[model samples]
Target: MGLTFSANLGFLWQELPLPDAIRAAHRAGFAAVECHWPYDVPAQQVAAALSGTGLRMLGLNTRRGGPGENGLSALPARGAEARAAVDEAIAYADAIDAGAIHVMAGFATGQEAEAAFIDTLRYACAATTRTILIEPLNSYDAPGYFLTTTAQAEGIIAKVAAPNLRLMFDCYHVQLMEGDVTHKLERLLPIIGHIQFASVPDRGAPDHGELNYPHIFAVAERLGWPLPLGAEYKPGGPTEPTLGWLLR
Candidate 1:
């Protein structure tokens, strides 16, 4: 079966406006698009762009708490702020018809932080019907981030116990933090809400990565994973030139 791709506009076409980025993804043969944050752009314009391009907006991240704060949900002292961010993400997602919202867990640790995250997730899940995602960022790239492993994320999901709450499994991070990507994918398939990928180490296009995306994709296909796996990578230059990997 032909695999579908979702261009992550946050990394691709960074030079263009949000609306223009959506159009670019459509023109580039991406089945859909996802983003880091779209709050700066008006929801109406973003909605219109998605409507015009006929591309599904896959998922988006909640607002980072403040400067140096990667996320807010796990901050024990920032309960109000975390919930506010969740509300904002839900509103924006609803307007643009995004499929999921990735709740960022800021720099934190311990039982208190876990409790805070679970509480915040409960609020987020009840507030919207859209799927809620929590990603385990690599400790190397995201040092001190609350979540760092798939097992940790799975445990949190079990604790939160919200059907809408699932994991955002990014291949690059998983490969960096832990190896054996294919086996982990099969094991964690039940709780994975979204899948994203980039080249390992440098976070570049997947074509030249240490990991073989084609084989990984084949394993994913056999697992009956959903369509449009996310292409979230830094292009280094203009995104158009880096898209050769998409056709491979």
Candidate 2:
């Protein structure tokens, strides 16, 4: 079978109904669709949309609070609060039957923060049946974020030693932060549970970017990684027009 792909609805529009965006993704030829936070829409509504379009919910961000709000994985100092947050996210995941949750490691203020993130991740791994993916955001996009390196995320996953916990490998962020994407992907394939991409310079369609997506996809295929490749890019225009490269 061909690799399954998911379109991120967050990048699709700043203001649009989730169901409509998902239907549009189906029309654009995506097998699945993801969103940042689906809390805006009821879980039942999201489920209905998925059923209506016959599209799967790839994943959703567990970080709900504002920018300054240290996510569950980053606020280990406030252990109770972090656990509560993880519980809330797990409940939502159960409701929507999501396959994964992108776990953000909030601001990295100090060593204490790192410890907190580790603790939070361990808790989340134990609590959720769905995979918990640790994303390494580029410092340029998210300054002070704790888990910014694939290596660091790998180490954390190793320490936890939980099969359910894995890395959310974003090609654009890794290209910006690490550069050697193919090598990194090869090295981290075992630990990586999810993959997302955007064009390098402008965060637009993959074909227009500096990265070689065909080669990347080929490598992924060669590696025999049985995971969905997330098309989490900002479409330069309508989703269909932007996806011509992939369809070809």
Candidate 3:
């Protein structure tokens, strides 16, 4: 099968609302779309937009605790809040028929944070039919991010060991934190819930980066991974014009 791609609405199409962004993604030839947090807009509205556009709503992240907060999944003191966030994300994802949900780890550390991460992931895995994703953010962008490397993520996944709990291996972040992406992608393909790409260092687009996206794509293809590579990057300007890579 051919490679597929998801438009990350969190950064792309900033000018449009959630509903319009879905439509824009469809027009741009994306197989699916994802958002950071769409709770502000009613789930029904986003669902309608997806139905109208014939585009899949891939997945979305739970709410970040607000300004200065990255996420809540690793906060040991906020277990109730984290579980509640899971329920809310489940409702929205189910409403829109999204197949997955990304559980953000935030900027947390230590034994407490690890315990919290395990507990939150366990709860989310038990609560929803949709796949739960755990991503490792780069320190430069998310300093003190709870999960920072594939090995760390693997260890967490091993501890959680939930069928539904899978790692979200983002190329941009992984490349920044650890180089050897192609091998890592091959090694982690079985448990990767989602795959995302952007230009390394700057996060401009998939092309013109320190890492070669085409080679990575080739590696994923050889590995027989069957999912859309999410275009999770800052357009640097307008999202529409930066999509020349798609045509190429």
Candidate 4:
């Protein structure tokens, strides 16, 4: 079977509005789409675009805590804000019929942060039936982010003990922080809710990167990954021209 891809509207088609981006993804032959933050756009407009284009809204993230905060759920002192962000994300995802909600863990550390994260995740899981995801960002890209490794995320998932909680395994971050991407995929397949990709080092389209995407995609197919892999890369210019990688 051929590999399918999801256009991360958060990066692609930056020139167009969110609704237009959904339409653009469909025209480009993407099977589905995901985004980082769609709260600014009206959910009705986004839903209308998804309905009109016949594409699925894969996932979205919660709000940041405040200035310089990448996320809120991991901050020990910001439990209320964290839960509020979770509530907002759940409501937005419901309006758009999104498949998952990635709860971002801001820059924090220690057992307190982990405890806060677990509590917030429990609240999020109890709040919605949709799958909840936690991604491990590379230190180089997101220094001090609470979640930084799959092992740590695995432990947290175990503590949360929610069936809907899963990992957002972004290949670029995982490869940069730790090698053996395919092996991790094989091992973590049970906990993986969504898979995302970008060129290593540069975070660009998959055509030019240290990691061989075709090989990785082939492995994903062999492993029986259920959904379209997410293409979360920077176009560096007009998104349309940068899409040669998708066609190739």
Write one digit per residue (lDDT tens) for candidate 2, span 142-192. Answer: 787777888888888888888899899999999999899999999888888
TM-score of each: 0.98, 0.93, 0.98, 0.98
Report the C-alpha lDDT of model 4 over 135-184, residue by residue, as the tens digit. Answer: 99999989999999999999999999999999999999999999899899
Ten consecutive residues with minimal summed lDDT in candidate 4?
237-246
Task: Pick out the ten consecutive residues of candidate 2 with the lowest summed lDDT.
Answer: 63-72
Estimate the lDDT of model 4: 0.94
> Relative to the true structure, how large is the alpha-carbon lDDT of every model?
0.94, 0.82, 0.90, 0.94
What does candidate 1's lDDT look like per residue over 78-129, in tens digits?
9999999999999999899999999999999999999999999999999998
Model 2: lDDT to the true structure: 0.82
Deviation of model 3 at 37, angstroms: 0.6
Q: How does model 4 score by TM-score? A: 0.98
| Model 4 steric clash pairs | none
The CA root-mean-square deviation of candidate 1, after full C-alpha superposition on the true structure, stands at: 0.8
Greater-lDDT candidate between 2 and 3: 3
> Cα lDDT of model 1 overall?
0.94
lDDT by residue for model 3 (101-212), tens? 9998888899999999899999999998789998998999999989899999999999988898898999999999999998899888888989999998899888897988
